[model samples]
Target: MIPSAFDYAAPATVAEALSVLADAGDDVKLLAGGQSLIPVMKLRLADPAMVVDLGRIGELSGVRDDGDALLIGAMTTHHQIATDPLIAEHVPLLAKAAATVADPQVRHRGTFGGALVHADPAGDMPAPVLAADAAFILAGPEGERRVAAADFFQGYFTTAVDDGEILTHIRVPKYTGWGAHYEKFTRVAQQWSIVAVAVMVRVEGGTIAEARIGLTNMASTPLRATAVEQALVGAALTREAIASASAHAAEGTDPASDLNGDAAYRRHLAEVLTKRAVIAAAGL
Candidate 1:
């Protein structure tokens, strides 16, 4: 199957890309790495009349440390994030997840922003981004606006990005004292996760001070396991406590049923994986 005929425009500047999108309106799609969009287009799931390619926009492709946060440009490739020394030291959770996304060939061409914007429930990036409490920088004709990771994803394959808006960068807070781990359960080496858990634990004096748990393929959007987080706070950083808290992973989630796993099966995997992730993150 081939994608429908469309007008292709590669803009050298962000302003030009935005102009193309604004003029093309809903009929236009922003092309970043095109790993996700191109497949959908070929399958005839998406039929945009125009594609505003951002590959030529040099400003949207770098990684930098911004004060207390790590700013990753939207166009940065997954392979770049996986191998970056700064990312490995500052946000190992992201680097770990990036390494598990698809295969090396896909990672070579896939963009972080493209994956996040695609908002697939099983995609690996969203869970870690949620656990990191990242923020997205969106640019449009009106200017730039910052959106939290929690609010940026509205539903499956849907985002809070309005028409004509382009996600330019992602700002992830530096979790200096936090121990992070990403545990993914997949059927094959390069397959999407059947269920994945991203855990970030702040341990103070052998006690759990703060915890954030994000679930992938457990709901319409990447869901924060708030119930589990609430249960872990102030608890002793031990395997028993982590197991007990992780039992609540499915307490508030509404996982979908699919070929990989049924809703109940996913709920079970969520609990099991979350426990393992939290224990590992807590060094238990």
Candidate 2:
């Protein structure tokens, strides 16, 4: 299907982009990497009156250190994040998740912020970002405001990014030296995750010092597995301990029944994947 014709604007700066976005009303769409939006547009799932390309905005791409955290520009490609030394060292969970996003070509062009703002419950980025406690920076007509991951995602295919707002940057607190992993299950290659678990743990003296868990495709939005995290803390870093903690993985989830699997199956997968993810993340 051919999408409806639309006017296009390539803005070199955030302020210029915001101006066009503000003026274009509800029929405007922002292009960032074009991995998700382009496909939908091609399918006629989305037909905007105007497209504002943010690709020329140089400030919205790259990784930088911001004291205790890392600042990742919204337009930074998944390929860059997957291989960036800063991300690898401080937030390996994100690197791992980014590397698994729809294979090489898509990874090369998909932007992290674009994925988050798309807010697909099955997306690889959201779970890990939630687990890392990342914050999103939004640029809008009223100026900038930061939104926490917990509040950023409103529902399936929805986010805190309003019509006139653009996500400009992401702040990920350093999880340096932590062992982390993203475990995902799909029906076929490059398929959306039926269920996935993102885990990051700090182990000290053979005990879990801290643990963070995020579940993908477990609800209307990415969910923090707080029960699993709480269970893992102070427990020994062993398969037995992880399995025990993982039993609580589905305690607060609302997985959907679909062709790939039923809700019960996803609940079971969450538990099993949580154990595998925790063990791998703990380097056991």
Candidate 3:
């Protein structure tokens, strides 16, 4: 399949990109990594009249430390995020999750903000962001606004990014002393996860002081397992305690039935993976 003929614009600045988007109105699509939009265009699922390429925007590609949080440029490649020293030191859960996305080549080209804005419930990236309580920075003609990860995702393949807005950066809070893990379940290598769990645990004196759990492909959006988190607090770092807490993994989930597995199977995987992620994150 071929994408419909469309005009293209490559902008060197966020302002220029927003200007282009503004002029193009509702018929334009912004290209970041081209990992999601290009394929959809070729499949004829998306055929915007114009495509604005943000690749030339140098400001939208890097990692910077900002005291309590790290500012990750939207166009930063998964490969870069996966290997960035700052990310590994402050947000290892994201690095671990980014490393597991697709394969080496895809990781080299796919961007972190692109993945999150794509808003695929099954994507591996968003889970870590949710667990870390990250915020998305969106730029538009009206100026910039920060959207929390929990509020950014709206529904299946939907998000807070509007037609004229571009995601410029992701702000991840530093989880300095937390042990984290992203446990993904897939049928084969390079395949999307059927269900995945991201866990970050702060352990104090052999007890779980705080826990954050994020779920992938478990609902219409990347979801925080608040129930599981509440259950894990003050829990002993033992198999029984982990199991009991993980049982609440699917408390408010609405998983879809796909060829990879049915809804019930996904619920079961959620419990299993949540337990594994919690145990691993807690270093039990």
Candidate 4:
């Protein structure tokens, strides 16, 4: 398979990239890391008139500490995020999830921002971001604006990033002392998750003080398990309590039936994986 003929622009800076995108009109696509876009284009699923590549934009890569939060540039690869000292120290949930994305080669090439923007319901990255309550920073012809992770993904393969806008950075608050875990289910090595759960727990006085639970492949968008999260709060971090709370993991989900598994099976996986993730996160 080959992509349709399209004009290409490799911009060296964010401003230059924005200028290119603004002039290229609505049919233009921005390329970062090229993991998702290239495949879609080759399959003729997405054939844009122009592609503005952002790989050369140096400012759009790497991570930095910003006060109580960490600002990660959009172009940073999964391998970078998985291995970054700052991410591991401050946001272990993100680091743990990143390490599970595809295989090592894909991890080395896939950008964190690209994966988020691609917004695959089954993608391994979005759950952690949603759990962490991260903010996505988008740059466009007008200027820049921030969209919270909760509001970013609108539906399957859709996001809040509008025409001529590029996601430039992601801001994640630090959760240094919290217990976190990412539990993913896949049919084979390097396959996308059939179902996955991300959990972060803060325990105090032998009870769960706070909890954030995010689900993958359970809806049209990556979902925050608000029901499960609420149920775990103030509950004793015991096996019985965790099992009771985790039963609510699929309470509000709208999972799809596919070859991998039907909606009912996925819903079951959600509960089982949620129990495993929460218990591990609580270290009980």
Estimated TM-score for each candidate: 0.97, 0.99, 0.98, 0.99
- Candidate 4 per-residue lDDT over residues 1-284, each given as its tens digit: 99999999999999999889878888999898899999999999999999998999999999999999999999999999999999999999999999999988999999999999999999999989999999999998899999999999999999999988999999999998899999999999988899999999999999999999999999999999999999999999799999999999998899999999999999999999999999998898
lDDT of 1 at 40: 91
Candidate 2, residue 138: lDDT = 96
Better of 1 and 3 by lDDT: 3
Off by over 4 Å in 1: none
After superposition, the stretches of candidate 2 with alpha carbons farther than 4 Å from their true spots are none
Candidate 3 residue-wise lDDT, 7-26, digit = tens: 99998899998888888879
Shift of residue 269 alpha carbon in model 4, Å: 0.2
| Candidate 2 residue-wise lDDT, 55-172, digit = tens | 9999999999998999999999999999999999999999999999998999998899999999999999999999999999999999999999999999989999888999999999
lDDT to native, each model: 0.91, 0.94, 0.93, 0.95
Candidate 3 lDDT score at position 149: 89
**Per-residue lDDT for 14 in model 4?**
91
Pairs clashing within candidate 3: none
Q: Count of backbone clashes for each model?
A: 0, 0, 0, 0
Candidate 4 lDDT score at position 66 = 98
